[model samples]
Target: MCACKAASVTIVDGLKAAETKEKCPLCREARVYEGALHMEELNILLSRRCPEYWGERLQHERIERIRQAKEHWDSVCRAFMGV
Candidate 1:
């Protein structure tokens, strides 16, 4: 995983707490990311074997979604790609 780039970290923490603005767009078109500290974890861990996560900035609902996605992805990739 690539160490987080503090300047690009997203830690603002929206209602859904999306890692990227595309995951959860706020205010219609004005997509604001989280603060650096909060996003540091994501930015750092993203390059790791782990697919990706919302980090601490995510809400319970979003956490579940991320978990489900990861679990599904892991199952599919492991079953097919053998990773």
Candidate 2:
């Protein structure tokens, strides 16, 4: 339910103690192992088996495309204005 559901957690101890158990953001399943690319740093793992991960990836891709489009338009406008 968190806004950073897709982001990896790097172990930050807030006012409350850190969570002892780790689970998938969408499926709520236990993450029993570390990600191969984590290198013992990140605590959360996003597995391909989770459908939500793929969904989030697609959403992220869409957002990135939108950002690129906005940047392209901004550049074109700037060039037109000769600024």
Ten-residue region with minimum lDDT total, candidate 1: 1-10
RMSD of 2: 11.3
Q: Per-residue lDDT of 2-61 in model 1, one digit per residue for the tens?
A: 112222322222323444443222233334334424545654675464444534424544
lDDT of each: 0.44, 0.48
Residue pairs with clashing backbones, model 1: 1-48, 10-34, 11-34, 11-35, 12-34, 12-35
Model 2 vs. true fold: TM: 0.39
TM of each candidate vs. truth: 0.28, 0.39
Model 1, position 14, has a per-residue lDDT of 31
Collision count of model 2: 0
Per-residue accuracy of model 2 over 1-83 as CA lDDT, tens digit each: 13122333322212123243555567766642234234223323444466688578657756865766687789999999998
Model 2, 29: alpha-carbon shift in Å?
Answer: 37
For model 2, the local distance difference test gives 0.48
